[model samples]
Target chain A: MTYCVAMRVDEGLVFLSDTRTNAGVDHVSAARKMAVFEQPGDRVLVLLAAGNLALTQAVMQLLSEPAPEDKPTLYNVATMAEAARLVGDAVREVHRRDAATLAEFSVDFNCSFILGGQIRGANTRLFMIYSAGNFVESSQVSPYFQIGESKYGKPIIDRVVTPSTPLDEVAKCALVSMDSTLRSNLSVGLPLDLLVYEKDALQVTRFSTIDNDNHYFQMIHRTWGERLRQIFGEIPNPTWADPANVPLRARETVSNVPRVTGSELRAEPDTSAPPFQTLMQPESGQSQH
Target chain B: MTYCVAMRVDEGLVFLSDTRTNAGVDHVSAARKMAVFEQPGDRVLVLLAAGNLALTQAVMQLLSEPAPEDKPTLYNVATMAEAARLVGDAVREVHRRDAATLAEFSVDFNCSFILGGQIRGANTRLFMIYSAGNFVESSQVSPYFQIGESKYGKPIIDRVVTPSTPLDEVAKCALVSMDSTLRSNLSVGLPLDLLVYEKDALQVTRFSTIDNDNHYFQMIHRTWGERLRQIFGEIPNPTWADPANVPLRARETVSNVPRVTGSELRAEPDTSAPPFQTLMQPESGQSQH
Candidate 1:
């Protein structure tokens, strides 16, 4: 499993990927998942991959090799869309060659990629290429794409990112998102490859290979969790007994939960059950009443 | 799809479940996923279900009806373990009757449950019942279980929950966890059933069927997201150029990312590329150097 997230905001594009790849819990190794395509004054492209390491490596191998004169490749694609299409084609090509062989072992041909960059004359664009070889580009309403172990880290991104977000701020959000994923999922490990591309730079510029020892990432890993707990503490705990409290009030209209008494097989209305009580103040002797 | 989470702490047990059930995205409706079996001064048990709504409903129906004289039932179970075993046995019975029929339609006999409660003279216990009718009890190390659409809501619980956590705080954590799940998944919807069982209470006490209008839940839904954004803003954004800064720095020992130049098929080491630059200060004009 892997976790890779990329964002395309008005300022530029941000790409981040974890390096851990595992065949099983015991067979784990690190492999860089981000590959940059750059031409100092002409174009810059980045690809972040997740899923079966073998399949992703095969696709990466194909993309790294020179293409035939008649074929499109990441190096010469005229626009970000065409670059994404070439990637999709490469994925399909790999599937055609390996899917049947892998099917014998019952391994699904799973692979996904986040492709984002700018050609010399084109605007910065971002896309998510699926296992099926189809792709979708990011839109104004949805300015980011995440692949693999995504759900644990998604709420933060969904709330913070937008097209107009600043480049550094986007980078911060991606790192924070990765920190959450790393904490919750053991399959996704460090050292990370982070690349922040400023639109129109037309070159590989701001990039870092982050390991556990990186002080800045260490700050994020520690501070984010501490701050989250702090904020969680600050949010007033639900006050069920007091309706006038701003945080929470147990209203009369809400229905009571049904319960089956020990003497009955089916749920029976227990007239003795209270409509509401504060679970927060269990020591007060009022919660169980 | 559904989302249900149950926790066991020193104070007691907490159970929360969303009411949404769907055959598909287009076919969604509300069905209470939580059921309680209570016997004042004797025992109390709560069951939360997720997966294959039809299969879960069948199992629930089986448990609700009177059991044969030779068999155990929720009402007569001698201990919490027996209650869990009866629940597991009920699941197997349902599987025996419906698995083949569901398979004929290519539907799975998939259902899971989180059962927790206490009987007279026994410690409160929690168990997760799988589709196979086998169950595992929660322990000190892992004091909670979540079923269906769980990942989005998992990080918070992983960070905050412990065997010693207070009951109301656990309840708050559960609500926050549910709020995250609800925001990320459409399959888990409004009108949640929340039940908090106090240790040794031996009856139903604190419970609520929370709809969109429930003030406490509304506070959670609104304030969690707002506070998260506030803390996110407080965290300093990454500073790329300064290794001395607290947030991030490019280390010297870390290898540079490989790049494929537009004019080259494979990556080439470009010594010309700058080692470090500030992506955060795009207006500084030093980033492109």
Candidate 2:
């Protein structure tokens, strides 16, 4: 399991990836999942990967090699979109080679990547490339892409990112997002690779490889937890037995008191009894009269 | 898809479930995913279901009927553990009857549940019952379980929950967790059912069917998102380019930057060395010149 997130904001792009890999829980190992390809002054491409480590590694290997003259490669791609397609093609190449053999052992061809950056003349762009060698580029409306163990870290991104967001701020949010992922998932461990690219820079600007001892990340991990609890403490707890005091009217309509007495009707037991008793009445809405 | 979380804290149990069901992206409808069977003064069992809605509905129908004498039904179970097993058994019963037929049509017998509550004379407890009809109970060390579309909402709970957490606080955490899940997943929607039980009460107490219009929930929704962004803003953004100015080190000892270029040499490289040059030699212990 890994968690990789990249954002395409108006100012630039931010990419972050966790470094833990595991064949199983017992075989956990550290493996860098982010690769930076910089032909300084021309292009700076960051690739964040997740899923089967072997497959991701294979795809990375395929992409690192300069493609034959007739084939498009990230190094020579005219635009960020074309660079993303080159990544997708690399993923497909790896899949075509290994998917069948791995399937014999019940391994799904599971792997994905986030490819984002700028070519000399193009705008910074972000994309999420899939196992099938297909991809989607991020846009202003949705200025980010996440791959691998994404959900635990997504809500924050969904709430915070916009194309107009400051590049530095998005980098902070990406780290916080990664912190959340690291806490919840064991497979996504420490030693994170964080790259912050300023639009049109054509060179890596901010690149941090954070391990457990990194101060800023440590601050993020601790502060986020303490502040979350503080905020959680401020929220009101449910009013259990009181009806009139309930916070919401619809909730007050339900009483916490139990309506049934040992499966024996609490009301008139005659067959002529009101048909209302059998209706889907929540215990919260009923009180023993 | 669904998102349901149940926690067994020292004070008691908390169960929360969202109410959205989607057969596909285009076919979405709302249906409650929580079912409560409260035999007040004796037992209170809350069932939160996720996965195939039809299958869960079937299991619910089967469980709601009077239990056979030999079968340990939640209504008559001696302990919370036994009740969890009964739920598991019921899942198996449904699977035995429905799985093969569903498999014939390329459907899966995919459904799972979180069953938690207390029975008279027993301690409060929680259990996660899987589709295989096997289940695991929560312990003091790992005192909660989540089912269906769970990952997105997991980080906060992972960081905040413990057996020692107060009931009200845990309840707040569960709601916050649900909020995260709701924001990230369309499959998990509104009109949530929340139940919080007090230990040894042997009766339902704190319960609410919260919808989008509920005031308290509206407050939580608004406040949580705002607070998250505020905290996100507070965290410092990465310092790029000039590592010397940053408080934290930005490079790792076994850095991946070298690997990026190394892999390139393993493949056909540049006939023209492009503009950026990989530094050919580095003094021992130094990553940058």
Instruction: Give DockQ per model, in order.
Output: 0.46, 0.33
Where does the lowest 10-residue lDDT sum fall in candidate 1 chain A? A280-289
Alpha carbon lDDT at A200, candidate 2:
82
lDDT of 1 by residue, A188-243 (tens): 99998889898998876688777766667888889888888887777666545522
Deviation from native of the Cα of residue A4 in model 2, angstroms = 1.0
Cand 2, B chain, TM: 0.85
For each candidate, how many residue pairs have backbone atoms clashing (under 3 Å)? 1, 5
List A-chain TM-scores for all predictions: 0.89, 0.84
Q: Each candidate's root-mean-square deviation in Å?
A: 4.8, 5.7
Q: What's the TM-score of candidate 1 when only chain A is evaluated?
A: 0.89
Candidate 2 local Cα displacement, residue A100, angstroms: 2.2
TM-score of 2: 0.86
Candidate whose DockQ is highest = 1
